[model samples]
Target: MSQVPMITLNNGVQIPQVGFGTFKVDAAVTQQAVENALEAGYRHIDTAAVYGNEEGVGAALRAVNLPRDEVFVTTKLRNGEQGRDLVQRAFEESLGKLGLDRVDLYLIHWPAPALGTYTEAWAELESIHRQGGARAIGVSNFLPHHLETLVEGAEVTPAVNQIELHPSFQQPATQAASREHGLAVEAYAPIGQAKDLDLETVTGIAREHDVTPAQVILRWHLQQGTVVIPKSVTPERIVANIDLFGFELDEEQVAAITALDSEERMFPHPDEGNFTMLD
Candidate 1:
């Protein structure tokens, strides 16, 4: 019953500010979860090749009976498939799994800097965008330095940069870098994985706003002009996550939440080159 606001990407494409994230969601249950999200008015759905649930997501999309253009679907290229040739094949494979000809957004899942092939992979994404296979293209888990390497010889600036952003790990430098390049920031772990939802600052703000700490954190993300994809398989939480339009966090509340940034990451640093998932 809540309306999700849309944010304009650099390419003039509008995306829902809050989306449903399918990370760590079991493939067996993904379809139902996505169905619930769509029913709850989540038009944007974010998943990745690494999540291994694209097939289920596709099934849900097909089952929903909504117009294809009514929903915004995003999937990412896997780390192993980082070369131009491999990326093309990977995109086709993801498309086949999703049962859709075009995705609303396509992202390079990670820079995988050690592999040293992201620039080439980015070229392939640009081609996909030009050919209309993807409405917009972006990168995930990319730090400022990684983005710098990507844009050196690139033709199209990345439309979005999905990163490990939450209250505890605000990623100010990376967020600033993204804004500098006209890239929209998408917060992947926007709720901090429930790690800091109970922090005094978060709870105090939640109490002041009379909402859950998760909602407060998500509101903070929204107020900061970032897109947030909070993952939840529970139907109630899925409904609650998008019910964020009613309240607004004040300047001091926003500053208090901003001060909670501890510079800690819930996921591995991109520079660590943790591509074991590819294996």
Candidate 2:
């Protein structure tokens, strides 16, 4: 089994640099997919309440029979559950669904700035962390400005900021801001969700490195000091995604991929205030 590298978060929690994500995975197959990932050597698993697969994830974890502490699990508070009281309740409900006492990490899934309660939600997450409901607390889909608002009033800095990042959308400004505040950046869609893997630059680099474009892209993320969660239901891809530690990218190759950044985001902008997921 390949050993995944770990990155220490600002709060001193250690997370695997490469993780398996269960974003769009169907609940029916989520268990088997996660099991395949674990059997393939992935110890970190990222899921969200809105993803509708927490139960499946729980089932897989139980089936694997590994010591609970040996694996890291992360889940999020849905956009609809954005206030202090609601977040607390939502977290308990998520725990119930996952059948776990606590998650390794719990995240406020999005800023939902229109709701005007993300900061309050952050406070609740802090309370949960204090009470040991979550080992670590953080936010997702949060822009630097949103993080600034959070930091101004927050008593504890977020351990991480999960964002939609890829070679095509490097988010240098956001990445820099996260580093400035000592928050670890976790990249969702680390392989561009297949959006730019076929680009000439990525493919050319892959050819030079004798790796698939996906491997090249994931390696780029790892080299940039970001945690990446690449999701796949296919067994081969799940196994292949974690097979990233064997190679390293040269500075020019890394720069060529970095230059592919145009700041084009594939997901909704957090500032746009779309909480349509609540609907």
Candidate 3:
């Protein structure tokens, strides 16, 4: 296994800087895909109830048979399931499917401001963490205002806030709030959903380093101190994503990549009718 870098959470847990995200992976194909990522030496696995693949991911875990502490597993509370009661039930369902008594990290998949219950749901997650059901609890896709409310009402500070953070969607304001609150930042779609794969700047950097564009981008996220989850079902890409610790990006190169932030969010907000809440 490569010496993958680790990011220290607020509670001081060291999580692998790069994780394998099993988002949108077909349930039928997820088991093999996750198994391939594990074989590639990925120590972190990110899944969610909305992804509908916790069972498949759990199967991969059993197949790998790696010691529990050696791998970090994370899951999230889905949008429709955001509430005191529903959130508690949703978490139990995820835990049951993942076949784990406690998750390394658990999160509110989205704030669901429109539904008007994330604050209460956050309190529920705080309870989950207190009960030792999850080592760390956090939120996803939350804006600064959302986080402020969470901080004001939450008994426990969220250890992380996972969001869309590709080069084009840097989310500087959100990142600032997370930092101010002592929350670790986790970047989903860190490679920009393949949008940055062929960009001249990214490709040029890859060529200069004799690495793939994907590797270059993942390296940029790591250097920026963001926990990145790059999802790939292919075995070769799984190995390629984590093979980034061998090189370093200097200040100028890092700045050039940082300049690519355009705040473009590939996934539309749930409030914009992209999703509907269920009772």
Top candidate when judged by lDDT against the true structure: 1
Residue-level lDDT of model 1, residues 193-220, one tens digit each, is 8897889999988888788889999999
Candidate 2 or 1, higher lDDT = 1
Clashing pairs in 3: none
- The digit string of per-residue lDDT tens for model 2 on 1-279 reads 446788999888899999999999999999999999999999999999999999999999999988998899999999888866788889998999898999999998888888888889898999999999988999888888998999999998999999999988878888889889999999999988898889999999888878889999999998888999999999999988889877899999998888888867898888895584651
Q: Model 3 — TM-score against the truth?
A: 0.97
How well does candidate 2 score on lDDT at residue 47?
Answer: 93
Candidate 1, position 63, lDDT: 95
TM-score of 2: 0.97
User: What is the lDDT, from 0 to 100, of the residue 67 in candidate 2?
Assistant: 93
- Those runs of model 3 whose alpha carbons end farther than 4 Å from true positions after fitting are 270-274
**Poorly placed runs, candidate 1 (over 4 Å):** 276-279
Cα TM-score per model: 0.97, 0.97, 0.97
lDDT of 3 by residue, 79-194 (tens): 78886778788999999999898999999888777778888888899889999999899988888998988899778999999998988889999999999999999999999999
Q: Each prediction's Cα RMSD? A: 1.2, 1.1, 1.4
What ranking of all candidate models by lDDT puts the best one first? 1, 2, 3
